[model samples]
Target: MSPPDRKEAEVRRMLDGPHPLVPPGLGLRAAVRGRRLLLWRRRLGLAGWLLFLAAVAFTVWAVTQQPWIPPPSRTTPPLEGW
Candidate 1:
């Protein structure tokens, strides 16, 4: 039989007549298919690339950001003994 028919049979067997747990056009092997897609994308170097660069840039900017307090406060001492 064709792939879709085979998948339908397997899905039917999995659900034991189908109630509501299965999504449309998805079978019991959806997780396997999803993992395959993720692997293919990773192999093609198409995963989280933009996110990686954005994270690196954010780190650098955060490291170089000026301190919250002003320069005068940096060396000022407490007035406890005054």
Candidate 2:
């Protein structure tokens, strides 16, 4: 049979049969794991924000400086002598 059909048959067999008992304190273990994962995710998010802000600041400074553009003339009085 195909992989999907095989998987469906296995699921059907499992649903028709009785389930095994949970070991003890499953909820407590799951809660502790979830809390640790949450804290890890928050720290990663803070670091990502700091990097993003630094890039934006660097871009702003580079564009505003515009060292390549020539400075404007103080007085425009260049007429053709020919």
Candidate 3:
């Protein structure tokens, strides 16, 4: 037989066989796992936003205080020809 005929015969054989079996409670387990994953994803997104906000707040505080710049001296410079 040609390729097409062979394929058709294989398909007919498969169709004539009994249906495949599935384990009980598989759908319930899948749904529960899906829900848990969605909740975890939501929590991660919230955490990312919180970290971003904290970084922005810290940057603003640092810029305003500018602790890296040294304080000016209190005393005046000595006279050149005193």
Candidate 4:
């Protein structure tokens, strides 16, 4: 094709915008939508994150709140001192 025709075609393509899911379209939209759906389903993602945090907190609390216990060897007699 002629130079002018080619340039015109290029400009037209640039202005035509991209196709979705199959061509040069905004794939980011799909990703964003997926994220939004996830957030929506999970109640704005905050609840999910808070739940995760709560699980971690519960685990830590359970571990740390336990009473201390000495080693078995320390609590046991040393074989009647040989």
Candidate 5:
């Protein structure tokens, strides 16, 4: 037989064979893992939003306060003459 036909026959034979055994608890374990993954993703998303808000708040405060400018002198300059 041709290589293609041989491959097809081999595949058909494998499909006709009995299926492998699966663990009884596989579905329960998968469900628990899926729930944990969803919770972790939600927590990560909330933390990302909180960090973004904090950064925006800090930027706004800095702009309004203008902390870079020096404070005014407390006392007046000395007299020019005695």
Candidate 6:
């Protein structure tokens, strides 16, 4: 049989067997864990967005300020033949 057919037959055979017993609290535990995972994911997403905004703000400041260029001279040069 083809690989797909073999996989389907194997799945059917497994389904025909008796199911295993699950713990009574499994669903409750799973729900709690799922909620925690969602909260953690949301926190991480917010942190990522905050970081991205900070980077964008820094870039804008850098572009506008042009920190790489030196500032203008504070004093005038010596007057020639005063």
Leading candidate by TM-score: 5
Stretches > 4 Å off in candidate 5: 1-8
Candidate 1 vs. true structure, TM-score? 0.29
lDDT of 4 by residue, 1-82 (tens): 5467888898999879875556555698888999989879889578889999999998898798764655356465557756
Local accuracy by lDDT, each model: 0.76, 0.93, 0.94, 0.79, 0.95, 0.97
CA error at residue 48 for candidate 3, angstroms: 0.5
lDDT of 3 by residue, 14-52 (tens): 999998888999999999999999999999999999999
- Number of residue pairs clashing in candidate 4, backbone atoms closer than 3 angstroms, sequence gap of 3 or more or interchain: 0
Candidate 1 wrong stretches, greater than 4 Å = 1-47, 66-82
lDDT of 4: 0.79
Stretches off by above 4 angstroms in model 6 are 1-14, 79-82
Give lDDT tens digits, candidate 1, residues 1-82: 5467788789889888657765676764787899999999896675578778889998888678855545564566767966
Task: Write model 2 residue lDDT over 26-55, tens digit each, in one string.
Answer: 999999999999999999999999999999
TM-score ranking of the models: 5, 6, 3, 2, 4, 1
**Considering TM-score, which of the candidate structures 1 and 2 is the better prediction for this target?**
2
Q: Candidate 5: minimum summed lDDT over ten consecutive residues — where?
A: 1-10
Per-residue error (Å), model 5, residue 1? 16
Instruction: State which candidate, 3 or 4, has the greater TM-score.
Output: 3
Error of 6 at 11 (Å): 5.1
Once model 5 is optimally superposed onto the true structure by TM-score, how far is the C-alpha of residue 26 displaced, in angstroms? 0.8
Count of backbone collisions in candidate 2: 0
For model 1, the local distance difference test gives: 0.76
